[model samples]
Target chain A: MSDRSSARAARAANPDYKILVVDDEPDLERLIRQRMRRHIRSGRYGFEFAGNGIEALEKLVELPDIDIVLSDINMPKMDGLTLLQQIPEVNSDIRSVIVSAYGDMENIRTAMNRGAFDFVTKPIDFADLQVTIDRTLRHLDEWRAALASRDKLVALQNELDVATKIQQSILPDTFPHVDGCEIFGCMEAARNVGGDFFDVIRLDRGCLGLAVADVSDKGVPAALFMMSSRTLLKGAAVGVGDPALVLAEVNDLLNETNDAAMFVTVFYGVYDPSTRVLTFSNGGHNPPLVVHADGSSEELELTGGIALGAVPHFEYGQASVQLQPGDLVVFFTDGVTEAINLANEEFGLETLQALFEDGEARSAREAAEMILQAVREFAGEAPQFDDLTCMTLRVADE
Target chain B: MNVQAEHHDGVLVAKVEGRVDSSNSQDFERQLHEAFGDDAGAVVMDLGQLAYISSAGLRVVLLVAKTLGQRNVGISLCSLSGPVQSVFEISGFNRIIQIHENRTAALAAAGK
Candidate 1:
């Protein structure tokens, strides 16, 4: 159970209720105090006596923490109905329990409409009165608990909003400078915080490191894992010679500390502008699409490996392909192909390949935008379940 | 959501009906806890009539599964409708818990 709910349960179990008892009968106060002597001694309830509704209001003003008002309908200066109406105005948190005659159903109903929380007959049995008091306190506890949870939810949403901003800031806004490459990346989380990350880092010897990854879980835990994984990959990629070796080192590091059993599927590549050659590695990620200048596309199914954090000391494989001028390599997470439409049909790999097959010439940024637009159009009214991320790299004409 | 429970073939079968969204997930959790009690036996969840489930409902199901696991009570889910099955699949819950085709299969799997 969450802290808020547990606290509510505790309050319901042991309540230190304070009640103001108002009545016109002069001897009623002494009788009640005597009847509830054991309760008073135990510190479960503390009482303030009032002869009429007007006096009850005064007591309430002095002690705003008073939780309940036990009052008689017929009083000298003020009636119970009048006090009930005024009680809410002074403090809406206060609940009123009316004392009425045995046959006063009409007045009891009237008192209820006027804001009485509950009622007990004039000839009140002490045992029945005790039960009513306990029941009324239980209701108050639940009401307060609900209010507390509502406030906590508002605060939690604000914190998530700030977290979303922090996650967005972690991504690279500008791609690395590569003479023969134009690169772009975009990420959209289904929730305020998501587990998708992409980066383009300029490595040694004018080589650019490009990566896209998706974590296994959702929300803050996934977001935290994504940050750690992205940081580790970027830290290892800069000094490492091989893309597969970089992933292997990061995988070992993640496996050592991954207590949550969370894993990430990643595609990491290194592009050398001088050779127009791209060396890449895949760790259980979806195969990227390589679209040739002739408007034909092929799924870039490289040597495969399991996702990071699943096993330690696991070997990863590397593959290379030379990119011709005007060729495009588009990388994405499963969220792209698995995107569902209103009809519950996936957008699918065929549709993605078709889009690339018949598309016109565009920059990396424009192409990324077009794909995102198509996904949104396909998803019409269906809710997005996973984080959507995509990256595109185009070889500029020589 | 409405959950009805009955003992059949030496197994507790909980028939869940309607959408188990955030609005009533708390009540649903309470109902499950009340129905299961302290019996460390076999429990079968029949989801043949369940239409939808949200994250809140999933959280409750996880809590119940953990509690029952700790108590050595075997729990299995059966008869998931299409939409609910999709939710379970996407969340990776299908990997952790045992799921069967129907109540009879679930009972047999639980060794009832």
Candidate 2:
């Protein structure tokens, strides 16, 4: 089918097409009625009459769904070109077709710029009028479809904003106040929702659980997986007091029915301020760095294991490290080190270790902020691709 | 990104030959989903010609893998270049999805 006829067919299921005919000449009404007799007889064209631009505006206000306007260029009260300019103010969706005398090319140009869709010269040709009307109707259909898609996009953006907020709310807002230790954690997603998460959960008898994880994807899917992984880790840690057992159980649980085949790299550590010791296990996560008081820094050693949810019957290996009063342990996802700069260089582990070893970290929060600032500066003008997460714990004297 | 698909021995081999970033990952995902039919026993993505991939591309791969896994179909990757291989390794995606050295190895692993 032709584009015009196809557009008409699509709108045929809707209400009747309405048109406003504006002219000072009373006989013009009779002419339009006679010309559109076939459409009028078939209930396809419904007409509203107006003598001038002011009258047309009044009718348009009354019949807001008037799809088209056929107005004379030189009416007594308000001319058609002025009405064309004003029609958009009433409803930009309404296509205005200017009716001008022959050789009135100047007014037609002005009308076209003023938002007239098309023009039909007087001594109105009925066949030419039909073509313009059909074309205008197709434009209207295209506008409505564009508008519908725009509305859908707006709704989707609103939903994503809410999802981001919900994901943020699920993370720990305030760090637990524990004696002899300072803890702080933060996360930044590349998109509206991120795949990175961190926790500073309070355990029994002055013990704290510190975990930072990165899901292997992005957007909503990663965010969903991150949430479940976060919840499972927290639940498993509280039920069993060991880091290895917690990871082992969480991994097994995720593998039980993980249809997504998604996986997470996590570093889970249980710290006891009373003993100044940390018991931890690594699930293929980036190793956490330790900076001692004497300006020496090194990556902590943990038993090797793969990421969680990838395989069943996997055992998580655990290790322990004694902390000094002035030592700080910094745990981070790969987003920090793998962060690329305009030069395409990564903010590698050595820079992070040097930041702590050089006395840039006076507090846990300061260390986390400084590390993020370093990454941001290093990654200047480059787009972030992954979720960034960090958690820092500093051993303090009692 | 250009994604071409061909079926061989009941396996769907999707050969991606360009960068799959945020701008075109959705289209890449739609094309892959269209290729992943019920009767397709295994899906082998040949990324030998794939120049680069962003997290958005990885997200689509994860989604497709999850859907096919639920349907009891296997998915594998073959012929990743240096940069793409590092990305997969860094994100630990290499551990989750099996990666083969070449298309022949991938098809053999897929039992095609």
Candidate 3:
């Protein structure tokens, strides 16, 4: 059988469906209703009537389940074409058909253009009307199903937005203060959430702790791992005896369930407030730059083991530096130095070190700002591919 | 910066107000230490009037709490607004510090 016949057969197989008829002529409406009574009486379908587009809209509001709208082209107050245009806006899932006694080519084209499901000329063909109603109702069912799925997708998007907000709220909002020291830091994510994180914590007995870390990969999973690592680091710093030992314990804790194959690069340190001394350990992280008081700086050589979550038994090594007053330590993720320009030239460590040689950075904050400005200038219009994060620390004389 | 201290029954209540940045953190710290110098049984801090707080402010709170913890004296923070509460929560201060909705609840929790 044809597609229309198949649709009608499907509707006949499933009794108890509804269709709405909208037209201005009472006689025509009566005749259509009388012809439709056979299908209604047979429990195949039900029929409702509307005098114009206005009445049809009211009926739609009252009964949202009115499967399809069979309307006339010429009607008082509101027409079939107008109703078709409004259907998608108000309730796009409701299928519509345009029926008219005077069916010209222009009217048919106009009705179809206005989003009518189909156009039927009126000489009172009951068989054709049944087929049209059946096909329209089938189309309406599919449209409604698609709309339901879209609504669910929108709800999921809203939930994700809320989750992102909660994650952002957990991060440190502002930097801390140290006497006679200036500090600067920035975090830029390629997506909603990033893997890079930095923190400056105050320790007991005139001591301060500093940390910079990069979780493997990006997005939600990385963000989650970053949070867990942050919490574990805080707990270890507060409870663990030494920085290297803290990383060892954190590594074991993280490797407990190592199925995801995720890992992190970290540099954790603690600075003595009285002696201007900072002791730190690296866990396969990038070496940070240590700027001296006499306008000189050098990269702190990495002396630690592999990154966390690589192996359960790995150990990190610690290093110490006596920072004089006005000395600065600059820590960053790979994003900053690796940021590329339109010419594909990376803002490498050499360029960063060169910016420091300008001798314009009087404080740690100025140093951070200068590096950020240099990177932005170098990148020009190129979009950031990863999270750009940095932290600066200045030691003060007691 | 506004610092107000009053002794109610055996509880010492200190109300801190305004921004607590590096410039005024020392003054706030000094005032808090002085208020707690008399070996008060319990100290309740009312932060409702506090509008802005930086890491310096956080350090002051942490220091006071640690000092009180060592002395076996209880410290309770109360009436924290949304922003101040957010700062504390982000820094994990809420986890270590005892935060209450009001001074009465805070004082009661501190065994005042």
Candidate 4:
């Protein structure tokens, strides 16, 4: 299951690894050199000699490429532990290996606490020292690889920002100009990108098509789903006059390759300017409120359809409501009613309806803003869990 | 969320308690499956204590139901509170899966 060994083999094979040997004994350098003579002769490892911790620090600053330091514990100027702490200041990439008297567990533990990568003992077994060196280098290689992957994650976050822009651009920013009425929509996107979106499309013959949909996930995957659903809904809406039929076709198209089992709940409707009637259908979405001209609002009757991409060829029902003068239809996703406070209580439908039922009548944009503002106030200080998207259609008074 | 199961007349009654949102939906699925196994002729999810269920949790329930249905295993739900019931209805889960008013009725129906 682990590819660490192979990764080490591929990366740590030939680097002429540089190690600084720090010991007070003058003869110890020659012994290490003679022992590692073959590795030095071949282009595998290069060794540098330092008499003590201070000298090692100097050599390290002089030769910045030294990868590891093998230091002895006892020295007059400075100790191995002191050098281990200073190595990071000079080059964080370097690791220190401590050498001490055999069976000196106390000093070895202290060396480890001070950031020693590994240790060798006095009367050193050269074979053990070789193994320790290989282990230390392998650890360093994996550490660097992990840091590199972290950088890739940061790059991925930047890509998510681009996705946010694409999602924002997909929704129809400018509401369609419908005579005898005004349409406005706003989506307060959550911190993490969600799949909530609203669109207003100008159809043929002065009929405006409106849609608000919420996909079932968050982040890039849900953003992609939201984009495709928006495109498919708009594509199907242009030719199809019936809200039920448009959704039916979009459902089939989305189901074709829904390997992730993702689904979207859509409320698609078309408004005829001449008649002032809006025919709409629901796809397992929360029913929107119809705020009448007198400020009395009622929840729209659900047309009885499951979410799209769940059951293909599912029959959908549609109904129409005549938009009386001064009437406003408030369309919203669950994010509005389902917005939760720190107390873990949802801003339920009753609260939303009460807010809309107030006396003063507002414009399309103003109505949408009022509802959003109420939800935000209700969830004061609690992080917005989902995209708070709402659309309003206000018929101008005669 | 937590799932407790007790067998009654070949039915595995899973008593789901607490909230099941995106964070714990995976564990909910695992616990439900561990309780159901291959032998229960029918399953009933008792949701009287379940406070909230997000779309993610609903997806899991749908998955279990569809998968078990394909294997000829019957699954139903019971005792969903008002808000939870509305959520299930809005998602149209009530149409595909049977929902009983209480555990007694759920067991009675599953026993048949």
Candidate 5:
């Protein structure tokens, strides 16, 4: 009828479970042990016993699987409540119940406050004790299940964190040290993974390949496509003489198995340090902005072709730009100019070009930072929507 | 930074003040987690009092937003000051995370 009796009935229904009893009185301990053995023999319970809190803790340490502790509040060396405190430190999983002849309100409150499962008066009711054990066991099961799930979630999150780090590591660590070029670049992903990539690769003597690309979509799938496109571009560029031929090969390779309906917009170029010439190809990419030494800037308009993976025989067009001393070229993904500020104003190409007019950025690295800073200033408290990828190349005098 | 949260029309409104940088990113994240964990409702983070935010802070926001996204939870930010708004703009966060000019707008947007 009472809460305690119902709990005992529940435990009696599941008798294979283990419960630990802790008390200092030898006579009382023996009587309790007898009652427990009788219950176990009758298929009503299974029990373990300790004479004091210290011995009880020792038993708990030895057998962590023990499901419940029914303890006396007052004892020698260590009180029942003290043992309860130790249980949480050693293993908070163990549920505890306190039994005492001194059933004062303060003592009961202290025992409960100290994390006791339940408390019983000195004149023990077997029904009440059983009910407490049964309820405690049910709660223990739920707690254990919850803890296991929490552990699993934590493990999964750790794995995701490692994956994110691995994805980042695959990007080029530093810009290639080109003799006649100063480089600056940055990649900002909208998510843990992103689809934009920019890299400068050193080819054979006197040549460096600069690339800025955007995949059709966002997140992990797009990131994978970007990685593949980057690899194929690098591989093809190494052997191909013309930048257009390099992109054609990359597009063909991607188009062959492009089942995800994904495509990439790329501006790939190879600059010759000896000749001060940059031969480039555009595949549905944004026109790159070139800032000359005389404080003039213009967009390098390369005729556009379909994005890579869009068609089997996509023909990319090539163009050439002659870079003199103090000339700079800036290439970026759509994420940059499309970035919206708090007022919903885009950090458009015009803003980016204006930042370059000030002439503060002497090196490519500084140029990249300046552009990024301008975008940051413009967005002003808005959230990022896409991955921002930018690469700047400065031509130095021979 | 100091973060305080209260429930408004079943949505959790988190008020963030001070600078959000590497030093306080963890605290910011913990407060969000606590607020969202309490009620699986829309969250509107008020940033009117925020002075500055670094890339580290940006990362924290992204991480929380992504988590909430996966759970089909809606998150919006309101009342960003000039500096804080710029960081999000440059980082392209403005495009991904919902932003409103004030609390009323953010709350209204979240309702949709």
Candidate 6:
């Protein structure tokens, strides 16, 4: 119940510190009330009296928010030394200030060894008692603050782990099976959940919709933003023939309340199986590589536009290329090319361009595997900072 | 990353060297802030020696541009080539901010 202690700590007209005073002498309670009257009136301190160790334990159990215990060593039912050991059992955070007689040095040493926070001589000077209470409370404040922040960090980490699982679940794990056309996609996750994601949508008339996007930041915030983008993009792409129009709609929706200033770079394309044509639009994302069955490879041109959610009402344009039988189109996030190595050199677009340049014919799955293997080999032992996602679609023979 | 400021007639040329990624972006932002002043007529970021920049680095540049824009002070960048130039273009940052071929060109067009 540190929570109750914190709430009590914030209230007005309530004591800053609550203390339990235990002593067998019947006059001690009256003397303490008279001595501490100013503290009680100013709301700086509240004192609770207990006749012996047994009464003190009961009082502490009832009012767990009690911060300090001021106890005398010699008592009828139980002594302060025995209560000192058991005080922690009630509340380990409770600081004990032993009230022993002056020159009771042996018992004082034993109390100190037994975990008494501080001690005051028993011809009890109320002034020394106040100083001890103030010092103990100061320490408790620091301890509580540190503990609260640590607890908050632990809770945040646990939530992020859950968020990572939810992010992974939303992505397409199994590519759609198109007759005579092979499709495959893979995402190599980084240590922290990143914003990279890809989706494959099977549309009417044997058409396929594909998307690969990277949100600006990593972790839970990016994951949440990516989820919104994925849902919006999928909904907008349905029954929409124009890739640019779909992106424009999703962008406007995202910018409605995009106060976090986050943005996503997305490449959305739809391929018509009958016409063998692939139409696509880019929102500041890297252009995908296209390889014809004849072994000609080229990058789709870049569109001079910012990532989605940066500017409102910005018109995005669409572009298209005719595909032939056995042609390949590869989509990827920046994590593929920007993957750093031991020399701090990037995997770079040149390496990817070269891989796509190969004249050999490869299936969609084979090409996806080849790209991943190359990136891993290039990175060597370097740590990956972002998730790497790649998707390949190969046009089959007529 | 290293941010070295050189004062010209009416502008401050901040020559940023090395790669600015997520790791040193905060330090990069601090050094860039330290290199420029509110009274300067203009700021020119020389990315000639800059090998690379991630989105985190772009955020620092965006903040500097926005802060200077609000104060009516001029801001521009120069000497971006290859991947760096492409990144600036794709992100559409090239549209909002001015660009020059070199530091001399930026200085000549300073405060315009």
Give the per-residue lDDT digits (tens) of candidate 4, residues A236-347: 9997779999999999999898866678889999989789888999988898888876668888888888888776788889999887888888899888998889998899
Quickly count the clashes in candidate 1. 0
Per residue, candidate 6 scores C-alpha lDDT tens digits across B1-112 of 8999988877888999988865687798899989986678889999999988876677678778878877988899999868889888877778778888887788788843
**lDDT (C-alpha, whole model) for all candidates:** 0.83, 0.85, 0.76, 0.86, 0.78, 0.84
Which of the numbered candidates is closest to the native, going by highest lDDT? 4
Cα lDDT tens digits, model 5, A231-342, are: 8988888888688988899989998896544667778898898888988887767778999876679988664555677556767678898888899998988678877787
Native contacts retained per candidate? 0.00, 0.22, 0.00, 0.30, 0.00, 0.33
Per-candidate total of colliding backbone pairs: 0, 0, 0, 0, 23, 0
Candidate 1's residue-wise lDDT over A153-198, tens digit each? 9999999999999999999888765688899999999888988889
Q: For model 5 chain A, where is the 10-residue window of minimal lDDT?
A: A302-311
Tens-digit lDDT track for model 2 on A117-186?
A: 8999988899999999989988888999999999999999999999999999988879888889899988
TM-score of 6: 0.80
Question: Measured against the native two-chain assembly using Cα atoms, what DockQ does each of the candidate structures obtain, in the order listed?
Answer: 0.06, 0.22, 0.01, 0.51, 0.03, 0.48
For candidate 1, the per-residue lDDT at B91 reads 47
Candidate 2 vs candidate 4, lDDT winner: 4
**Could you tell which candidate, 2 or 4, scores higher by TM-score?**
4
TM-score between candidate 1 chain A and the true chain A: 0.90
Ranking by DockQ: 4, 6, 2, 1, 5, 3
lDDT of 4 at A18: 90
| Candidate 3 chain B superposition, TM-score | 0.94
Flag the better candidate by DockQ, 1 or 2.
Answer: 2
lDDT minimum window of 10 residues, candidate 6 chain A: A4-13
